[model samples]
Target: MAPRTPLFRPNAYFATRSDVLFLGLTVFALYVVETLVLFYALMYLLLDQIRDAPPALESAMNEVFSTVAVFTVFIAVVALLVVAAIVHYGSGGTDTDGTFADAVSVAGWAYAPELVTMPLSYLAARREIATLTFDGSDPATLQRQFEAVQQSVGPASFVILLATVVWSVYILAAGTAGTHDVDVRKTILPALLVGFGSFLLGVT
Candidate 1:
C-alpha cells in the first residue's frame, strides 16, 4: 500500500498486528546492528588490558556482553508498550476510543519511518565505529578513549540524529492519531514525549 504521507503518516498503509512487525524491525536494530557495534567496541576496549588474556576468555566475554545488547531490546519493547498503553488511556474521550490492541498497533506502525532513516543512520554510525582506533592500553588511556567515544559527535552524525528525531515525532503523532481515531493535534504531546524517550535510547 502506498503511504498517505510519506514524510509524516508512515503507518497509514499498515494493516493490523503492527506491534509484531515493529518488533521484528527492532530486532535488526537492537539485535544485529546494536549487538555487533557494542561487541566490537568492547573488544576494542579490552585489546590492551587483555593483551595477554587467553583467547577463550575473550570469546567468553563476548558471549556475556552479547546478552547485554539483547537485554536492551527487552527494555525498548517494554518502553514502547508503555507508551501505547498511555495512548489507549489518553484517547478515552475521543469520538472513537482506542483499544489496547490498536494502541499497540500505533506504537508498532509508528516505527515505520525508521525504514527510511535507519539506513542513513547505520551507515553514519558504522563508519564512525569502523574508523575508531585506540592505542590506549593503560587505565588513563582507556578512560580517555571511553570519553572520546561518548563525546564524539560529528556534523554528519548529529544531522542524522536530528533527522531521526524530527521524522519520528511526526510519524508517531500521525500513527497515534490514525490508530486512536482522533485528531492529529490530540496525539502531538504523546508523540513528542515518546519521541524524546526513543531519542534518549538512540533508537529514533
Candidate 2:
C-alpha cells in the first residue's frame, strides 16, 4: 500500500519504484564522487610528475591517458551494476518487463552528488588520507616512494569499498522504512552515504 500522502512526490516513475530507484541513485551518486575524486587526485600526481621532469612530456601524456582509460572502464562497470539493480527493482524485482530508459535515468543521477559534495568538502582532510609525498633529492628514492604511494592506494581503496557497501545498505533501509512519507523524516541515511562516499572518493 502506498503512503496516504506521497513523500516528496518524485517524477512519475519514481513514485512507483522509490525503494529500488533511490538505492540505485544513491550508489550511482557515490560512484561518480569516487570517480571524480580519483580524477583530480591523478591529475595532481601527474602534475607533480611533470614538474619533476619537464623532458618526459610525451611519456607523461601517454601515462595520463592510459591511467584515465583504465579507471573509466572500472567506474563504468560499477555504473552498470547500479543500473542493473535499478532495473531489477523498478520492475518490481524482475526483469520480465523492465525498460532500458528506467536504467538510463538511474545512471543519470550518479553525477549529481558530486556537484553537491565537492565544493563543501574538506580538502585538507582528504589529502591527509590519500597521499604520502616525499621530496628527497635522489631520483631512485623518490621513485621508490612513489611506488609505495601506489601500493597504499589498494588498502585505502579497500577501506572505501567497505564504507560504500555499509552506507548503501543504511540509505536503502532509511529511504524505505524510515518514514511512510519521505518528506518529513530526518533521514540520516543520505547524509551518511554522502559523507562516507565522498570521504572514500577523496582518499581514492
Candidate 3:
C-alpha cells in the first residue's frame, strides 16, 4: 500500500476526475506495450512461414495482424468495463449501491501492481521453458532440469511476487467492498475471482 499508488484508499482517491484519467491512461499505455511485445514475439515465430509467401498472401497476413491488433485494443478497454459491470451487478444483493464509475476505476486501478508482478512471472516462465528445451530428448535429464528450475526460484523474488499479488488482491477486495459499500465478507468471491484472473493473465 504505497501512499502514491492510490490503492490504499481507492474510493477517496478516485473521486477526482484527474486521478481517474491518469490511472486509466497509464494502465492503457502499459497494456499497449504488453500487446506490442506479445505480437512482436508472435511475428518472430511466424516470419519463416511467410518468407516465401506470395504477395497476395503477405497482404492478407498484414491485414490479419491489423485486425488482431485492433481487436486486442478493443478487448483491453472492454475487459475492464466487463469487470466493472460484473462487480457492480454481481455484488451481494440489494443494499449494495455504488456507481459504475466506482467499479470501473477500481477495476482499472487494481491492476497497477501488475507492472511489478508480470515481468517476474514472464521471466519465471521463460526459465521453465528454457529448462525443458530438448537437446537429446532424454527423459531423465529433462526431468532433472525441470526439477532444478522448479526449485530454483530465489527466495527474495518469491517473496516479492507473493507480496505484490497479495497487495493487488487486497486492493481489488478493498475496491470491491467500497464499490458495494459492503463488508469484506461479501466481496470474497469477486475478489478471489478477479485476483486469480489477473494472475492467470500475467503468467500466460
Every model: Cα RMSD to truth: 4.8, 8.3, 7.7
Q: Please count the clashing residue pairs in each candidate, in the order shown.
A: 0, 0, 0
Estimate candidate 1's alpha-carbon lDDT, on a 0 to 1 scale.
Answer: 0.60
Q: Model 3 clash pairs?
A: none
The TM-scores, one per candidate, come to: 0.68, 0.44, 0.59
lDDT of 2 by residue, 1-204 (tens): 443222222223344563444555565557555655656666555446433444564466568767876777687667555543543343343323334444433344433333434443325324643444454456576567656665554443455445444444343323332222233133234334444554555455
Tens digits of per-residue lDDT, candidate 3, 1-204, equal 224556567544543333464575577568566755655553433433232334454466577788878888788788777777666666663556666666776777766776656666566545444434432245465446435644555554465566676776676667667655777666667767766775555433
Top model number, TM-score: 1
Off by over 4 Å in 2: 1-13, 16-42, 49-54, 57-62, 70-74, 86-92, 95-104, 107-111, 119-122, 125-132, 135-140, 150-204
Q: Would you list the clashing residue pairs of candidate 1?
A: none
In order, the Cα lDDT scores of the candidates are 0.60, 0.46, 0.60
Pick out the ten consecutive residues of candidate 1 with the lowest summed lDDT: 13-22
The TM-score obtained by model 2 is 0.44
Worst 10 residues of 2 by lDDT: 4-13
Give the TM-score comparing model 3 with the true structure, all chains together. Answer: 0.59
Better of 1 and 2 by TM-score: 1
